[model samples]
Target chain A: MTVKINTAEQAASLIDKYDTFLFDCDGVIWVGNELLPSVKETIELLQSKNKKLIFVSNNSTKSRIEYIEKLLKLNINNIKLEQIINSAYSTAIYINEVLKLNKDKKIWVLGQNGITSELQNFGYETLTLDDIKDKELTMENINNLIDLNVGCVVVGLDFQLTYLKLCITLQYLLNKDIPFIATNIDSTFPFKNTKLPGAGSVVEIASFSSNRKPDAICGKPNPGMMDSILSHHKLNKDKTIMVGDRLNTDMKFGSVNDIDTLLVLTGIELESTVSNGHPDVTYYADKLGDLYALGSK
Target chain B: MTVKINTAEQAASLIDKYDTFLFDCDGVIWVGNELLPSVKETIELLQSKNKKLIFVSNNSTKSRIEYIEKLLKLNINNIKLEQIINSAYSTAIYINEVLKLNKDKKIWVLGQNGITSELQNFGYETLTLDDIKDKELTMENINNLIDLNVGCVVVGLDFQLTYLKLCITLQYLLNKDIPFIATNIDSTFPFKNTKLPGAGSVVEIASFSSNRKPDAICGKPNPGMMDSILSHHKLNKDKTIMVGDRLNTDMKFGSVNDIDTLLVLTGIELESTVSNGHPDVTYYADKLGDLYALGSK
Candidate 1:
């Protein structure tokens, strides 16, 4: 059962229950370059109370560092590297810390710099589209271009996706020994009242072509990724409340992980959709700004 | 029960049963540029006996004229346009005769020249990758590149596929009003002791990205394509027999359409696996050229 947050006392009581707050970046705090109304005040209020604020985004198109830069530009500064957990960063962490892949086992990335840059940060070599984007991929030369040294393949949102990248990625995926990891399968991301193809859709090409299932999908509402993030950061699960705009990815992520959830109306879902899909939402607010009722800093 | 054709008497008996032969060109008639042994004699014999032979291939990479040219190079001559039924041609015939689309409703193709050429042959204008291959595709310019005039989207094997083609194809597909057609979903086509991504694999990218299932998949083991070919050519069902190697595609195609099938052992399938997948196969042969035992011309 979800309670409506209309009164300042109700918002304060609910906000007081959690020591840490996990936020879905896109629709919760900001949309694109502009932050939602009262989001600044709400963050400031939480910061004054010394509540741990972490931004978790399913978007693998941008790295956490890039996200930080974007967030800073929006004047939401003082975000530490670990405080932001984008899907690309989650995937990189999963591969490096969890998978503990040997240094010799190179990863072939079929995504944007978000994935490649994050993987590089983990001290792993990756074959990006840039390495062979200009090289001709004929039947006679495809074998030469395919690096057998690649022991893993990472897929994410790649706006610059090409047939050559897919072909190379499929070749790597064909080897069942080489683990396949996808950032997310969100299909379409919300864009200007429309939906654009997401990381999951991009990964489907290689999956369909190779007839291989991904070994790991590092995104919500997957509990594995959430577990990895929580464990990696030593986050107190009981005290951390998931606050987001969407019920499926955000609320469901909290529900699946047994964490409390607050549904904010500033993103994909409206109050009407609240009655459907995920009924496990703990609370619903008209906007993230509603939490500004418990003002401070 | 599948009768094995080994004896000359059995071959002659089988040959006399059918007035028309539906051959899968890749394995039944020829493998690449090389025609199977005794194929020339068998075809000559069938021609002399007034057997109406129709070449059906799931390969949408080439048009009927192109197939005819390739056939001629292999010493197979006297082929008419209507005698060939490639998946691309089947798609064209289905769109023209069955769908009977409006002239103003143009089609955007995400494939090789085979599909575009065939669609053009049927007097339908198409927007191929060539039209926008040079243009820059950004968020700002994508709307201009998408021709909402496209009433249908056709997908097939495209070795020269690009991100622009997929984005444009996805945009056209997102509008549910436009019909989506794929050549086939065979995943991979058999190459020299290996498998390469097929037309089906190529189509999967756009299908995945758009999250829209195709209106029609014009290939084997789909009986729709076969029905179109038969209805167009005015072939007698009772006299026609599908002869091919692969059980899943060629044999299953015949089985689904309630047609007699002859499994040839020159392609993807072996004689052992025939008893597994499609048990409806009427007969099995060591090779297609085994029909040479029924010699005449």
Candidate 2:
């Protein structure tokens, strides 16, 4: 399809027709601590038009409250706590739902503080590798431990990845047919000024060694994350547009769920690099300024 | 398709109709160095019927002379050098043909002594990582070096694999977009009674790092190896039956080239594993002794 007009009237008309406007945090509203020039104006315009606004980010390191605080600091105040969707929040909901079905199950988590705290808050017993330091670890020992108590493996990004951890995880999964769940499947994470292997890389290594794929990924691109957001906010899919720069993650969410996508060429994926053009992208813009132009009309 | 069985009388009747009987060396006669019982008898029997027997192996690690020596030790004597079809020979021929078409070209050979020597014999100048050892090495310098005078990259199992070698090769390939040809795709190699990562593993790493698959894999499971065998020996595909045990490699060879395959259970792949069955295997035998049952008619 043709790239829609960059005028404010056309964008406003599209926005008015759709109930939910999902904005990608990075590249759309802000890039690292700096907000885009028209991000606040565009959000205000959408609010005035009686449209629901939600910021969806695949970055699982931050929580909803963290994102809201960041946004409020950028002068985009009046943002509700429920308006942010992060992979970690989706993962927390997934764990809670799974725990509700199986009331007495223990989960071994491989993530940062936010993930462990969230799982514990859901009344599930959570253990880390550090918690079992005294145990003699082998693939067989790990399998026996998992067979006895561990219900499911909950994996997230961990900066201090070790060979011992990978070995133990792979052995346990391989010996006993254990199902694994990951927060996201992003191969790399943008850390400081360079790229580092993310949580997905750990999942990939374990999956490759054991020949078992993750049971479910509770993150972006998967409908689970989007569905969690929509269900939480009582938002309809018919009136939702997913705005992101990456096609595989952002556009995939829109395409899989039949939501409109607004592809902005301001993030990780460059315009010239996206060869497999998605049919879901209803609008294309160079920056958030073009989006504000649509809001004015 | 129903497996067609030609009785001894039928075989004897049609034995004179065919001139050359091209035999696959691996599973037909032996698994590695161990000879199959009645393999000699079968060859003698075929020769008694005035048929020419030629042995073809996709394993390029050994030269035609080496194969002749191995066959001679197994009591199959006086086999001509021209009867052999191997990737090493084919690689030499490919480099010669390419060089004939384009005279001024340098090739980086990432393989063993066999392939390197063969390519050198074909009048093409071959370079290895050792050739660049004297030069100052850095990622930038190595990348710049790869951009100079590189024509083609030929890959095979290199025992002396290093990170520096891999980085340089990948850099040259990514920068220049040079054509890559792999000698084989066997992921694991049977060595000293243990399986080690073979040529396919290195090829996979290079492919993953550069995001470009080999231009052509000049070995097993590809039509190139089979076609070279058929064309060089002047054998028709209809009469040629590839006898091998492995389903993925040997059976895949017959499947792609429309040749019949005889699955012998004495090798790497077992008979029970062939239950799901490939369309390529026209016949199955527990061992060479079972073939004598057809001869008894």
- Clash totals for all models, in order? 0, 2
Clashing pairs in 2: A8-A293, A8-A294
DockQ of candidate 1 (2 decimals): 0.56
Task: Provide the lowest-lDDT 10-residue window in model 2 chain A.
Answer: A138-147
Model 2, residue B3: displacement in angstroms?
Answer: 6.2
Clashing pairs in 1: none
Model 2 per-residue lDDT tens digits across residues A121-168: 667777676777656754335443333466777777765444345544
| Candidate closest to the true structure, highest DockQ | 1
**Mind giving the per-residue lDDT tens digits that candidate 1 earns over A1-297?**
778888878889877899989989888888877889888878888888889998888888765778789878888877888898888888988888788898888899998888888888889998875776656666656666788789899998888877667777877887899999988888877655555677877778778888987888889888657866876777888888999887778898999889999998888787887654456698888888888853432
Residue range B1-297, candidate 1, lDDT tens digits: 888887888989888999889899887888877998888778887888889988888888866788889888888877788899888988888788777888788899888888888899889998986766667766546667777678988998887776656767878888998989888878887654566778887777778878778887789888668767777878777788999888788888888888899999888777677654447689988788889844432
